[model samples]
Structure formats: structure tokens, C-alpha cells
Target chain A: MTDHIHDEHCDHEHEAGINWQLVQGWVQTGILIIMGLYFIDLALPGGQLGNYINVDNFGWLTWVGAAIFLSMGIINAADLLRTRPEEHHHDHSHEHDHEHASAGSLSSWIFLGIATIPLIFGLGVPSKPLSADAISGDLSTNVSTINFGTSQSSIDIPSEQRNILDWIKAFSQSSDLREFEGQAVDVIGFVYKDAQLRGTDDFMVVRFTMSCCVADARPFGLVVDFPTGQEFSQDTWIQVKGHIEIRSIDGIDTPVILADSVEVTSQPEQPYLYF
Target chain B: MEFDLTIFATRFLGIFIEATPFLLLGTLASGLIEAFVNKDDIARMVPHNPVLATIMGGMLGFMFPVCECGVVPVTRRLYKKGLPLSTGIAFLLAAPVMNPVVVASTYAAFGAGPVLYGRYIMTALVAIGVGLIFTVQNRPQRILRPQAIFVPITGGSEAVMPAESERMELLPGIKKALLLAHEEFFEMGRYLIFGSLLAAAMGTLALDKEIETLASNPVNSVFVMQASAFILSVCSTVDAFLALAFANTFTTGSILSFLVFGPMVDIKSTMMFLGVFKRRVVFYLIALPFLLTALLSIAINLNIRL
Candidate 1:
């Protein structure tokens, strides 16, 4: 594959025609630059990056990636300008006996196309956070057993200030579910109804807890027992003003929110809770 | 379930963005090794005995901290630098999980517990065991692809260039390194992209429900977690936290298997492995680690409790 590096005929003049190898190299360089810029855009605050990943964990790494891409693109651009003929000559090995080099270049072009897949998806598709549709049966309603690092008890935080994750963490840390009973709760999360809660007046108010990105996202939420819970469709973001109540779920006594009001709300700017 | 383009795109890009940096890092490391590190240095560093060398290879990740995404290109580069096949294979398998970054991450997720210790130990055993298999049945021509098989400069092959004659000064070497990095980024990045796409497409499927159903069965859970690890292809650095989500549900042994086997061979790493090793070797690479991890984990599941 690297036989062209030792080619003695590297200084030969090129014919007056379209240089497909040069074009492919230029396109690869352009894609690299675009990818660099795309990563930079993802790193920027208030960008769509949070929709795809928990930027809090990987935000700085994204910047480092941008720098690497930009440097690689620059090096590629430099290689194009200085050694254009020498690099391009190997692609036309049909005239010579460098069949291996020609095959290598052909495979390189295929690889170049493969490298462009991310660019097409990143730019062409509109970014959106993973919703209830992204959740399979891996959803976690029993958060008591999950060890999300050191849990900061949300029990101390003023009732309305705690989010779904904080409440879940607090529950995980506490032994008694009854302690959370009657705690005023105002949390916003997307609706998710399990098959078991299909006909019941209860549905999970869930937020995906992501330590890395959406690929590692696992839904965690508290069950909201509301008379009109059936009205809220799955993946619809909603704010439920309610009070906590310990209820028998399956065979375990779990903390279930008894909602006084459920109002539809827009998805949060950062939809996922960072673990 | 109906396919959602937006969700698919989001998941695809998510894996892409998360994995690409490590791929870039791998290429950069590969370039640096190609430019600066010589064949003699690699030969001198590796022990002469195959067993010790394989064990040393497993421990080499401490010196080089890289995830599975970064390990492939570096391993290929080392092979090019005339690193022994057994050592290279061991490094390739163990480095992803044995590194300090992964150790810290696993510790953060599970603490100084059996999962943390079991993960590293199982990875070492499996990696060394596989490396030993290569040691017994060593054949570079058959195991590695034509390009990946190392040809010594002393072989006097006409197509090969002498190392001392064409070796560049420091500045030119740095420039050459950057150029090689640029070339390698595209070469390895293609596999990373392809694997990420496959993983993302699979992510949109309801495979989780099927897998979760078998979580309670000690025997099946090990296979299920390993299968999940292969399909998900989550980076080893943060995969501990991902495994944590299943800590309460999956058996301890199965979680350890996921931690050990996932980093050694996944969809993306398997694609990268295909780039370096021949098709048959790639199958052995996947199957060896898969079976080794599964057996060890199941033994723990059935016999001992974590």
C-alpha cells in the first residue's frame, strides 16, 4: 500500500486532464475541515450538541477533537499543495506496473466515502434528543438500588427545587420511602407509560440519565399517579405539580408522585440529566 | 417498532462524536510511533520469552492510555515496527480495559469492589490466554493481512527501503509524522465510522427488551451482556457507567463479562481488527475472547457470589 512512497518516478509530469485523485484528496480535506468546524459548533454552549450527548461530560473532549481534525485537515491541505503530482501519480499506475499502489488508492477512495457518512448525517439530519421512543424495556423506575456515585440528598433541598434525578437520588440514599411522602414536588419530564401501567392512572415522568452520550442513556423517573395521566402522550414534556406518596408498586413500596396538576411543557434546553 | 430517522441520526452522530476523538488520538499516536520509535526499540522492550512478553504486552497499556478506538491503529503501527504477533495481540486485547483511565472510571462507577478487580483480572487472563494461543500457532503470513505483516529492512527486499539511509532529521520527522497522521486518520476513521453506523442502527431496535428478559438467568445473562457489549460498542472509558445502569438487574458475573469482553472486541474494534488481521484471524480474535470471558464469568455466576 505504501509502495508509492519509494517510487523513483514521482517527479514525472502529469497529462493535461482531470486529476481524479487530486479531486478525491481535496474532497477528503474539505470533509475533514467541515468535521472540525462541526465539532467546534457542537462544543459551543446552547448548541444542538446537548441534544445528542450530555455535553457536561464530553464537552472539553469535543474541543480537543476539533483541534485534532483541524490540524489533520491542514496537514492534508499542505500535502495536496506540495506533493500533488507525486501523490496523484500513484493513482494512474495502469500506465506503470504499480498495481498494488493503484489498488491502495482505489480502497482509499472507498474509505474517503465511508469517512463522509458522519458529515452527511451530522449536517443533513436535524438534531433531536432521545425521547420515550428511544427507551426500550430498559427503563428504571426502581432507582433505590442504582448507585449514581455519591448521592446528594434532595430531601434537604426545598421541595419544588428538586428535579427528577435529585428526587431519584434522594430515594436511592434513603431507606424509608415514607419520609418523601407529602414532600411538595414540581418536576418537569417527558411522559413514558410502561405496559403494566397501560390502563392505570399512572405513568412515569422520566428523564434519560446520561453519563456519556445518548448511546449510554438509561431512562429513570418517578411514577406520577394522576387521574388524567392517560391524556399525556408518550414523549410529551410536562410539568407535574404534586406531592410524593409511598405506594405499593409491583411488590415493593415505592415513592409515587400524586399529581394535583399536569401541564404540557416544552422540552428543556438540555433534555438529559447528567449522572 | 417504526423507525425514527431523527432518533437514528441522533444516535449515529452520538456514537460518531464520542468515538472519533479517540480514533484521531490513535492515528496521532500511530504517526508518532512510526516516525520516532524504531523496530529495535520495540524488540528490546518486549521480553524474549513468549509468556512473559504476552504478560508484558497486557501491562503496556499503563505506558499508553488509549481506549479501544485508539488501540487498533497503535497496535497496527507497532506490528509495522516489528512488534511480535503475540505481544501485539495481547496489547490489542488488554490495553483498552487495563489502562489507568478505564481503571479510574470503573472505580468511579463501582468503587473498590469485585467488579473493578474482576474486570481487570478477567481481561488480563483472557488477553494473555489468547496471546498464548497465538504463541503456539504463530504464523504472521496467515494471521495478519499482507500490509500488516512486518517485513524487516534487513531482509534485503528490493521493494523495501533501508531505515538509516532515508531516516529524516527531527523537523522533517515531525512533518512526516503529521502527514502519516493525516493518512491514517482516514484509513482507521472509515472503520470507526462504519462500526458506529451499525451500532447506531442496532440501537434504534428494541433489542434491550429481549436482552433484559434473560437477565435473570445466570447462564443466558452472561451471553446477553456480552452480546450487548458487542453491539453497543460503547467506549471502555465510560462503559463502566453504562454497565452500572444494569448493575441492579444483571448478575455480577455477567456485568464483569461485559466489562472484560466489550473493550476487547466490539462492533467498531472488530471492524478495525478486520483491517489489520486476516478474516479467519479476526474470527478467532472475537471468538477466543468471547468464549474465555463467558466461561470465567459463568463460573463466577454459578459458583461464587460477588
Candidate 2:
């Protein structure tokens, strides 16, 4: 009985031993909490907020997830302190080496360092929305591919609400875009240079679209024929007042908005279109 | 490769932030199973008939609803609890995309298009096919590493001390789950970071004018999207939205390939596979899905209405 009790006490001590695993665990917890707080702490939903998630409705889900990490960290920290260090659960082989996995081990440190990189950068770096440069980037090259109609959204309304996304959706569902030709649209997006619409003042007005998060965001838009397309700088937010017309771009009859009026505007609170 | 810092950081955090919740949910579920469910019960529950067990495993996500990032650890916990190799593998592959959340999301993104139905059918086929491949084997001992083997639980509830009685020790049992969850999260999260890094690198650098150029051809388009799917590592919960974005540019079949094959095999989950299976087995696991998804998707791409 005495031997068993002593063994239990030793086990408690071992668990409580301060080591690299416990430290890493606390750090992991901190990383999760900080990432969560970064989103929750925003005063106005900014580009960084959109960088991680798309819908505000499900924003609270992120907080719950971060709280799990925080609580788990506290639990590990509590365990480290409560048990007073006789021998760690994994450190039974030698007279030395105290750790949850292995204290001061090379792999342990490497994993810890790798785990900490994101936390370091995530906190230090300021978040920017995917810019016009995104088009040249790998993921955004196919800017016209994203389809954005929620079946619940009625595109057949008297005035089609073809924000860059709505245009893609209507363009995608129809074999011939004649139905949409001459339809007036009030579309807002950033000016992006398109290879196909090279000259003659044809630049795309695009809004990047996201489903679950921004990593998956893809630029979705239609070519806007502004007489001064060459003058407006790439990535300048602009509102195009126009009517949709089917124009042949690189073979296919694609929708292009003939802008009657163009006005410069600041980027909106929610820059990316969400589903 | 010179990574644009902003692009890389945005994508890295994006994948991590998006996947973290599902991963947490998976670990918590794993903890609950580890704490409450006995090893024998899992063994007993998994049907013995190879085909039935494979189908059952593939369909397990109807109840579990874990994301691809999170399902690995849950499957690992189940594997450690004596779940048949066939069932565990099928569940691991199928649950991420096959669950109702994936279904609703896929439907929402594709609007009942072939991509939606194709995503379901292809995921099931790949999952059940992989599961059945393991059925001929003698309990996969050679494939699994020593660390992954099922070990008898020695501690009481795995979270609390053995001296505590099982009936009255609910909090400690839960504490045990949290403790185990933290440990599991650390173990699995390391791989997740590596996967996300590779994915971010690929997302930032690899996609370019060549992909857009090749996307004009049906065959090349399918291959490009499949490769992109493997590289992107977007969570299954929202990949359909990503695929929907590709709908107009790529064939329905190619978009379907992206939707079906991505969650099944990707950089992030592929890295995690090394933690669970032997090096050679991981290669085979990857190649099988890659080949099958490619062949079936290409076939659909060729035959389906363009």
C-alpha cells in the first residue's frame, strides 16, 4: 500500500515537471487565443477580417474555437503546476530527460519553432485584402470563373442586381447572354487589367468572392468598358453605371458592361462578396 | 521560392483559421470517444463483412460531421481503439466531404449541378474502394507505425487517476478529454502547419498564366484542377465555393474533380498521412486516390455535357 502511494506521488511529480511540451502547449494556446482575438477585437470589419472568414453570421464560431484552445492551455498549465515532478509519463527510459514528449529534444524544439512561426507572423503582419496584383498571382488568374448566384437570389428581377458576382452567375447559367443585354446595372469593384481586354479602354471591375474564408477567395467580375480605363489606376475602387452587352472576348460571347458613368469610391467595409 | 509575404501569410492564416474550428471539433469528439467508449465496443460495432464495413465506414460521417483537417485525428483515435483498417480509412476519407454540412455547402455552391452529385458519388467510390483495398490484409500491422498501434489503456478514464470510480468521475472524465485533446491537437497541429505552408506556397507561386492557358482544353483542364485541388488544401467544408468559382472556366467534370478529389488528397492531409501510415503505404494511399479521381473525373469530363 505504501509502495503504491509513493508511486502515485512520484507520478504526480513527474506530470508537474516543467518542460518544453508544457511551454509549447501554453504557446499554442496563446497563438489560438491571439488569432481569435484578432478577429473579435476589430472595431469595423476590415480586410484582415475578410482575409480569414467571409460571413459575419458565423463569426462567433471562431471565438468558440479559440476558447477551446485557451481552456486547453490552462488545463495543461494546471496539470504542469499541480503535479510536482517525480517522472514524466514518457520519460521512463533514462535517469535524465524530463518531458511530456521529450524536453529540449531536437525534434521537440523544431516542432515548437514551426508551430510558433505562424503566430509570430500572424500577429506582426498587417492584413491586406487580395489586391489587383492578385490577378497576376496564381489563384486569381482565372478571375471570371467564380459563379455567385444563391438559388434564393432572383436574377430575373426588373433590374438584375449584377454586382460582379451576379454577372458571373447570370453569364454562367445562360448559353446566350442576350437576355441580359442592355440591362442597366450599378456595379462596384476595383479596376483590374485583363489580358484579353488589352486595349481600347476595357478593364474588368472585379470583386473577389469567398465561401468559407479568404484563402479560397477568387476574383469574380465582368469587363467594364470605361473610356478612361487607361487613366484609372489598377485597384482603384470604382462604381460603373452601365448596361450589359455581349462582347466577343477571345472567342466566347462574354458580358461586358458599357459604362455610361464612372465614379471613384473608397473600398467598402466588406470588400469581398460572400455567399 | 520567393514568396510574396502578404499573399503567403494571408493564405497560410486563411487555411489555418478556417480549418482550426473543425480540427477542434474533431479532437473534442476524439477525446469523448477515448474517455467514454471502450475499445471492445468499437471492434464490435464495425461490421465484419468487408464490403458492408467499408460502406458503413464511408457513411460514418453522417453522424460525425468532421472536416478533412479534423477527421484524421478522430480516425487515428478510432484506429487506436481497434477499429478495422477498412472502416477507419473509409471514414477518414469520406467523412470530410460526405457529411451533411458538405452536402449543403456543395448544393449551395453548385446549385444541384453535376459537381454536387459527382462530388458525392466520387468521394464515396474513392472511400469505399480504399477501404476495400485494406480488407484483404491481416490487420494492417505492417502498414501502421509502432506509435500508431492500439495500446491498452492503463490509466483510469485516460484523463483522471485510476483510483477514481467511473460513475461519479464525470468531470475528471471530461478533464481527461480536454487533456487528451490538447495533446492530440499539438501532435496533429504540427503537421497541419507544415501542410498549410506547402499549400500556401503552391497557392501563391504555382498557379499562373500557364494554368489559365491550359484550362481551355478539357483534358488538361481536369488535370490542372485536380493538381490545384491537391495543392490548395482548402477545407472540405468550403471547397465547393472554390470549385463553383472555377465552374465557368473549367468543364463541369473538371470542377467536379476539384470538389471530389481535393478533400480526399491534398498537401495538408497528405503530410498528416505520414503521421498515421508507413512511408510506402502513404504513397499508395495518395496514388490510388490520385489515379482513381483522375480517371473517373477525366472520363466524366470527356463524356459529360460541356
Candidate 3:
């Protein structure tokens, strides 16, 4: 008799607790939003985010964005389509809350749109490269020929001599560092020695660190055959005293640094190189 | 028309593949917790002390370690079981930011130094702070509704018939977990792709140069980076790369803000929050983290010499 009573009570509770409509509504709405965003992107031609959309550098990302935008829009639209608006039998207590929500949606949309404007504009522009002089630090005066620090170059060099030395030669012509010959300037960086080129005392390399992204990181190695070539290792951070000079390596005139002294200091707490 | 047709078909296929894994993992963790942990468990754990509850909620990220996508469904289940709104909210916030996987990835990206340690400490503090703030102001009962649970059983016509009690056993529970994980992965993955695409497009179109100009003003720069982090949609794993790319472009404060804030809140994460919490609750969760992140970023940048 007790078991029967418990079973009957549980059934009543279960029946009263089910809110199928809300769950179904969520599923429907989610589908609608996802679909809508994608369809709109397709129909609108280039997504019309002029000054808002970019795809030039990282083309792999375009497919990813299209997926997310379309999915959310479709889901929202689906929810609206399936659920017939049910008239709420407003309990006197909840009526105030409903009225507030009705008033708030408009403001919410406006806020969302306004917030997205700068975001759109930021995405639509091309990136500006940090100029060569900025990283090498005003080599226009006091340095004979500035070394190409950790920055990347697009110049074409000979196939046989296709390394940093070759890169420096090609980069030098464009930046016109040859004109700055006979001037002295202070250069800061860590020391590395390339084994391939350095015969007992041949080359010393310097690396620059970029805090977040490495693509823009420039490596400016100063080729100094100073007597103390054996002192530095692969990543030993150091500041060397050197002046830029033109030297012949592999039949090409390359800008090399002749070191006056090499000082090994404690790795500065922040090792990143910045302009 | 030819271009559109090819692009549409390619995009559809890409979305399906990307969303599957995350969804699977999210569902697996969410389902198991749902099946075993109940309201009494939460009520007993909390209510005794808010401090203890906050610690417990924050630490739960280690045990379950659900991604942002799976967090909501698991969180929704907890709400149904009567966990406090603040505790559930805290769990949602902490799980994604400081989970084992995310932590490991962060350590790998920044190295296990102040960047890693600071991120862990700050993320926990921020999550707990937000949770407590909400708890003091609002009642969990008012905002959370009971979540619906769907269970399917086989019958005589169904090729696989099962006893009623056996149907509710742990295997079905595992199946539910897997399913939820897959769905959540797909959802979050889709958003992540969208963000990266938008970021890349902006990179190519013209905004890349504009971002550099904005970096001139220290304060406005922070705001721009935080906003870009959300719009870019890069995953936490690779976001460090994107942040590094802009090293020359933005101020240190802005770069820090972009790295810290992007993982915590984004458009997809916001939508996921809406799916779980009430609109009001979602509003606070979405708005508060972004504001807090922006403020914290500026403070860190201003004070620290580095």
C-alpha cells in the first residue's frame, strides 16, 4: 500500500516538472541562428564588411569564421519559426519583470551594434611593418654599414650564398646603409656564433626577441672575428661593443661589426627585444 | 555564383569536422557529472562557508576540466540540482580559463614563469570575485530553472531491447557524455574559426594598419586589443602566436589585455552562456569578465616596469 502511494506521488511530480517547450525552443532557436549567419554571409557578397573584413594574410581562417556566423544565426531563426508564441498567463508577481525585458531588448541590440563598429574597422586595414631603421636604431649617422638584425627581408640573393651574409648584402642596397659608412652607433643584442662560417675567429650572431609574435622578430648578427670568439654559446645573452664596417665574405661585400669588447651580463629579466 | 557555391559547400564541410572533438569531450564530462552528482551534494558542500564553496568551485576545474563548450550543460545540470547561482557561475568561469589542458598549453606558450603563474593566480581570483559579487546581490533560485533530462530506451520493435532499470545504468550515461561533448566542441569550434577568419580578413583588408595607429594611445590601445581578441576568435592554444605577431603594433598593456581576455570571453562563449544561464545572469557573466579583464590589464601595464 505504501509503495503504491509513493509511485503515484512520483508520477504526479514528474508530470508537473516537465518543460518540454523551453528545451525545444532552445534547440530550434539555436539551429536558426547558425543557419541565418551563414546564409547572410553568402548572399551579402564579401560579407560587405568593407573596412571590417580581412582575408589576405591568413586565408585558412575564412572558412572558420563562416561556420560560426552561419550556425548561430540559423539557430536563432529556427527557434522563432518552430515555437508558436504562447500567451503567458501572467502571474501578478512576474508581470513587472516581463515588462522590463520587453523594454530592454531594443537597447541591447543597439549596444551590441555600437560596440562592434571599431572591431569591424580594425579588421579592414592592412598591417604596417616596423621600418628597418626603427629596429636597428637610427643607423643614418655614426655607423658605416648597419647589420640586418632579426627583421625579415624580401630581397633576392644568389643561390650559393643564400644565408644571412647574402641577405645583408641585398638588404643593404635598399636601406642604403652603404652611405652611413665611417659613422659609429651603439647596437644592442645577444651573441651567437655560426659554426659554418667562423673558422677560428670569424662570425658572432645576435638575436632579437619579440614579446608576443615572432614573425616580426628581427635577427641582427654582428660578424666580429674578435679574439674572444670562443666565449659565447648558442643563446648566451650579451652586449658587445662594435662599430659597423664593410668586409668581404664569399666574394660579396657584407656589413660586419668589428667588436671592441664583449661583456657577458646576467640575462636581463625581460629578454624580449622591442623597437 | 560559382565562387559562392564552392565557398558555401567548403564552409559547411569545415564546420562539421572542426566541431566534433570538443563536443565529444564536453558531453562526456558533463553527462557523468550530471548523472552522479545531485542537488544535495552541492547544497551540503556549499552554504556552510562561502570561502570554502568558492575554493571548491574553483578547484572543480581540475577534477572535471571541461572546455568552455561543455561547461554550460554541466553547469545547467548543477543549477537543476540546486547549486547556488554564484557557485555554478564561478565553476563556469574557472573551468575554461584554468583547466588542466588550458594551463598546460599556456605554460608551453609563455614558459613556466610569471606569465604562466600570474595567469593561473589571476584567473582564479577573478572568477571567484565575480561569483561572490553575484551571490551577494541575487538569489540562485530566482534565476535558474530546472534543466530537462532526456533518456531513451529500446522497446520490442526496436532491435535492441533493454530492461527499464538497466537502461538508466552507467553505459547510457557514458553515451550521453560523449554526445554532449561532440555537440559542445562543434559549437565552440565553429565560433573559434569565425573569430580567426574575421581577424585574418581584417589583417588583410586594412585594420591591421589601423591597430598600429591605435596603439599610440596607451589606454585606448588596451581597449582595442581586448576587443580585437574577442573578434579574432583564435583558440587559446595559438592566440599567443597572434599576440606575438602584433608585438610591434600595440603597447605592452594592450598586448597583455588581448592575451588575457580573449580566452575568458568571446562571442561564442557569450552565446554559450546565454544558452545555459537566464538572460540577466548571462548579461552579468558576459559583461563583468570583459570589464574586469580590461581594467586588470591596464593596471598591470601601468604598474609593472616590464
Best by TM-score: 1
Expressed as tens digits, the lDDT of each residue in B33-124 for candidate 3 is 65556445566767667766766677677776766555666776666556666777778787776677777656555566655665666667
For model 2 chain A, where is the 10-residue window of minimal lDDT?
A: A90-99
CA shift of B156, model 1, Å: 8.2
Runs of candidate 1 with Cα error greater than 4 angstroms are A1-16, A84-108, A138-141, A145-158, A227-231, B154-170, B204-213, B304-306
By DockQ, is 1 or 3 better? 1
Off by over 4 Å in 2: A1-29, A32-36, A42-47, A87-101, A137-154, A157-161, A174-182, A242-254, B110-117, B153-168, B204-221, B245-253, B298-306
Summarize candidate 2's per-residue lDDT along B1-306 as a digit string, tens digits. Answer: 345787678778777777776777778888877777777678688887879988999999997888888888888878877878888888988888979988988887767766678889999998899888988886567877554567555654244434212322578767778877776776778888888888877663245666767766778888889888888788788887677555666777777778877888889898887778889988888888878888888888678564
TM-score of each: 0.90, 0.84, 0.49
- In Å, residue B30's CA in model 3 sits off its true spot by 1.3
TM-score between model 2 and native: 0.84
Question: Which has the better DockQ: candidate 2, or candidate 3?
Answer: 2
Per-residue lDDT for A1-275 in model 1, tens only? 22233234432332334444566678878988999999998888777888877787788888889998898888778877888354444221222233123322566567677878888988898888988888777454466876665334566888789998888878887888788889999999999987667678889899987878777877778888998788888889999999998887687878888999999998898899988
The whole-model C-alpha lDDT of candidate 3 against the native structure comes to 0.48
* Order of quality (lDDT): 1, 2, 3
| Candidate 1, residue B264: how far the Cα is off, in Å | 0.6
Please give the RMSD of candidate 1 to the true structure. 4.1
